[model samples]
Target: MRIAFIADPLPSFKIHKDSTYAMMVEAAKRGHDLYFML
Candidate 1:
């Protein structure tokens, strides 16, 4: 599956605190392709 996330700059994410980042991590674990857009 392919997942796209429209989010802030990647470096700005706090992995422990950012929900979107967490979701991205989970998606990646499940083998989905992730794309980010500003």
Candidate 2:
């Protein structure tokens, strides 16, 4: 399956540990194609 995420930019520090990043990471691990949009 493929998944995409669209979100406004997070604060710089927040990106490192943000939930969105985690979700993307997990999705990639599970073999889902991911895309990001502002």
Candidate 3:
């Protein structure tokens, strides 16, 4: 499946305890297509 994450700039993201980033990472690990729109 394809997933698009339209969020704040990934560079500026404070990933500590970030569920959204965690979810995206999990999806990527599962081989889903990932798109980021800053």
Candidate 4:
């Protein structure tokens, strides 16, 4: 499956407790394609 993640624009960001990042992690584990709409 193909998945796209959109995130807010910021100078710096943290991955901890980030749902989008967590989703990407799970998606990768499931072998899904990832695209960031940054």
lDDT of each: 0.95, 0.79, 0.89, 0.79
lDDT per residue for candidate 1 within 1-38, as digits (tens), equals 99999999999998889999999999999999999999
What TM-score would each prediction reach against the true structure? 0.91, 0.70, 0.82, 0.75
User: How many clashes would you count in candidate 1?
Assistant: 0
Model 3 TM-score, all chains together: 0.82
lDDT tens digits, residues 1-38, model 2?
A: 87878876645427676888888889999999988777
**Model 3 regions more than 4 Å off:** none
RMSD of 1: 0.6
Steric clash pairs (candidate 2): none
Best by TM-score: 1
Question: How many pairs in model 2 have backbone atoms within 3 A of each other, for residues 3 or more apart or on separate chains, i.e. clashes?
Answer: 0
Candidate 4's residue-wise lDDT over 1-38, tens digit each? 99987886534556786777778899999999988787
Candidates ranked by TM-score: 1, 3, 4, 2
For every model shown, the clashing-pair count is 0, 0, 0, 0
